[model samples]
Structure formats: C-alpha cells, structure tokens
Target: MISRLPGLSLPERVWNTARRWAVAWWRILYLGAVVLVLVLSPSSYGKGTRRALARHLYLDTAPVLLGFTVLAALISLVLTRIVVVTALSYGLSRYALEMVIRVLVLELIPLTAALFVAMRCTIPNGAQLSRLRQAGRFDALRSQGSDPVRIELLPRVIAGVFACVTLAALSCVVALVLAYLGVYGFNMAGLSGYTRMFGQVFSPSVTMVFVLKTLFFSLAVALIPMAAGLYDSGERAQPDSELGGLARMFAVLLLIETASLMGNYY
Candidate 1:
C-alpha cells in the first residue's frame, strides 16, 4: 500500500519492518525460553537420559568438530601472522594481540561455531522432526505416555548447545595459542605483554558481554532448529518443509552476531 507513495512510504515501510522484526524475534525468544526451561528440568533427563545424551552429544560429536578446530587454527595462524607482521611494520605491535583476540576469540570463533552447529546439526534435526511429526510419531509417543519434547527435542537442543560451546571454546583456545606463537615466535618475552593486553581488553564488562554473547549464540544454535521443527506440530496442519525454520534460524544467527558486534564496539 505504502509503496505507491514512494518517498512518504519509505519511512513508514522501514518503521513497519522494524516493528515486525522486533515482534518476531521477541516471540522467538519467548519460545526459546520455554524450551530451555523444559530442557533444564530434572524430569527432562530420565534416569540415564542425561548421561546417554552427554556421551552422544560430546564424545561422539567432538572429534567430528575437531576438524573445524584445525581449520580455525590455520586461519587464525594466518590472521595472527598478518596482524603481527603488519603491526610490527607500522610500529603498532602493541595493539596487535588485542586486535587478534577481539577479532578471533571474542567475535569470529563463536559465530563460526554457532553457524556450524546450525548447518550441521540443527537444520537437519528440525527437518527430521518435522517429518516425524508429519508421520504421526509425535502423536503415538504422546498417546503412549511418552513426552516427545523431553525425549526427542530436548536432547537435540541440549546437544546443539553443547556442540556450539565446545566448538567455540576449542577454536578460541587454538586461536589464542596461535596468536601467541605468531607474536612471540615460541619465546616467553611477550608473555607479560600478552597478559597485560588481554587484561586491558577483557575488562569486567567486556568479559560479561563475551560470556552473554556466547550464551546467546549457543541458545540460538539450539533453539532455532527445534522451534522451526515444531512450527507445524499440530496434526491438523498440512506437511511443510522445515526449510522455513532453517532460514529463520540463519537470519536470527546473523542478527545475533550483528547485535554482538554493535554491543562490543559501539
């Protein structure tokens, strides 16, 4: 309607889009919170469910993601060398480590991990859940006195969170080591400077933000796919591809990263 007005409609259209986006994300966060609560409950993890889920989630998936760690480290090494060499040439070596940590550890690693989980785990999982629901498995499970959300969705969400956290942490550790190696050349002379630079960069507030951002990343990784999968859980609905869920999740991931960047820098 407003597009007909061109100039006048531009502002109105932007306002409408922003309002709709805010509402959509708020609803997503509310649903995510509800799912998290269910997963956090003691009952969600049956007698051996938590243990079994952990083994499957951590042990089984960790090695597969180690490849990502190696790749991340190699990339980090390149970036570290570039930053160090450039900074040294420009007499900005003092700022090199801080830049490396901020870019790699605080920002890049977490986003990469979250995206990897989103693609490798959650999106497919959501599609599978959608198909299962379409097949009446959910109804059968519920009718048999089984909790589908707890038994099925909870594991995937928890596992997604675990996977994101593990990947991000491992990548950050690798990047940190590479940064040190690149800047110090296997020597101890820069250790004091490194510690001081890191401490200065990661003040209490900055550290809190980093933690909160990582938590949000993990939550987004877990919640989006499950939320998307459950988008049409009602039996009365026609079967629909969970592609919408994956798309929405990717959109949310980008938004989360953008917000994190703005929060940290602006």
Candidate 2:
C-alpha cells in the first residue's frame, strides 16, 4: 500500500519543475548560439576578418590536437590491455583486435573524447561568461573600446571546435594502433585487411562528412554550455542551471552523431 504513494515528495516536485525550466532555457540558448555562429561564419565574406578567424582557428586547434594525442595514447594503452587480457582469458585472442577497433576506435573513443572536453572545458567557458556578466565586464569592455563577442567569445568558440577535432583525430589514430597490436600480435599479415577496412570505413566523402560533423559537434558543445551560462540573471546562479548546460551539451552531441550516422548509412 505504501508503494502506491507518489514517487517524489514536495521538495522533489519543486526541484523537478526548476530543472525543466532550466532545460528549456538551455535549448533556447543553444538555438540562439547556433544561429549566431551561422551568421558570423566566414562564408559571409570579409577578407581581413576571414584571415583573422583562420589564424585563430589554427592557433587554437594545434595545441589542443597535441594534448589530445597524448591523452588518447594513454587511453589506448588501457583499452589494449583490457582487450588482450580478456581475449587470452576467453581463448579468442584472434577476434579481440577486430572487436576493439570496431567498438573503441570507430565509435567510443571519439565520442568519449568529445564528451570529455564538453564537460571539462565547455562548461567552464559558460561559467566564465556568467562571471563576466555578473561583474559588468561586458559593459566595461564595450566602454574601453572592445567588441566582447569577437574578442572573448569567438576565440573560445574557435578553441572548443579545434579541441574537438584534434582530440577526435588523435583518439582515432591511437585506437587503430591499439587494435592492430591487440589483434595481430605484431605480425605484418593483418596489414592488408586493416588497410582495406580503414579505406572502406573512411571513404573520401565519408571523411569529409565526418570532419564537418565533428566541427558542428564542437560548435554546439561550446555554444550550448556558454549559452546556458548566460541565462544567469544577476542573482545566485541556480544549481539546476549548470546541470541544464551539461544535459544540453549531451543532447547536442547525440543529435550531431545521429545526423552523421544517418547521412553516412542512410
């Protein structure tokens, strides 16, 4: 009979309502940010602005790629260890590498790296904006002859996008190496099939689409969290606000993946 009662108490109900409001606001902010990026994209065309933007893109992305390469290498080691141990235990060592590559490199590693940065860096990007908003820094910058959007937010957006691309690429490479070692035991015979599969999975058009999708994912990941942070209204930021930012980031990441999968497979 007691089990028939409501699953949530009054405080929980209030919390849930607040959570819903925060989520809705996050969606609105994400949409707005995307629109803003589209409007500002280089396709709109101004030579000086385009050059500056390109410089920022490369500068921000290069270091991130290097960092991600090292991190992905570490993750690859752990994953390789697990696959090898499991395969030997199960007497299926030959199949282990293929499974590891298929599951880890092609899917999980890139996705996980994207999520890691979205949480680690993107959330802080939003929080920084929130702090700026609270401290009247935007106004001060404007008064002191600065375009806050271009100077502050655009660099961050570029950095986030570069970080995602570099991390994904590095993770993919590391996973491939780990898969090969795990499967072939350092023999050269597996190279032919590995190359064939790699070519098949990474066809030219597919590669282009993957790159574009990663860029979109990076843009959304950075934009949404920052947008949510901007929702603070000078009062103490709500706990639900940051959670909402995270939820939106996850949602956007999934949306980008789904769209990419559909384009590639369907």
- TM-scores for all candidates? 0.83, 0.68
Off by over 4 Å in 1: 1-27, 233-241
Model 1 C-alpha lDDT versus the unseen true structure: 0.76
Expressed as tens digits, the lDDT of each residue in 73-159 for candidate 1 is 998999998888899999998888899999989888898888887778877777777778778989998999987777677777778
Models, CA RMSD each: 5.2, 6.0
Q: Give a tens-digit lDDT track for model 2, residues 1-266.
A: 01122577877667766665656665556656664775477543356445655765665566456676777777777887898799899998866665666556656666776777776676777788778877988889799976666655665666676777778877787778866775666789989987887777678877776777777777777677767766553334224367766776787778888887787778
After superposition, the stretches of candidate 2 with alpha carbons farther than 4 Å from their true spots are: 1-67, 84-95, 144-146, 185-187, 203-213, 233-240, 257-266
TM-score result, candidate 1 = 0.83
Highest TM-score among the candidates is held by which one? 1
Weakest lDDT window of 10 consecutive positions for candidate 1: 232-241
Query: Candidate 1 — which pairs collide?
Result: none
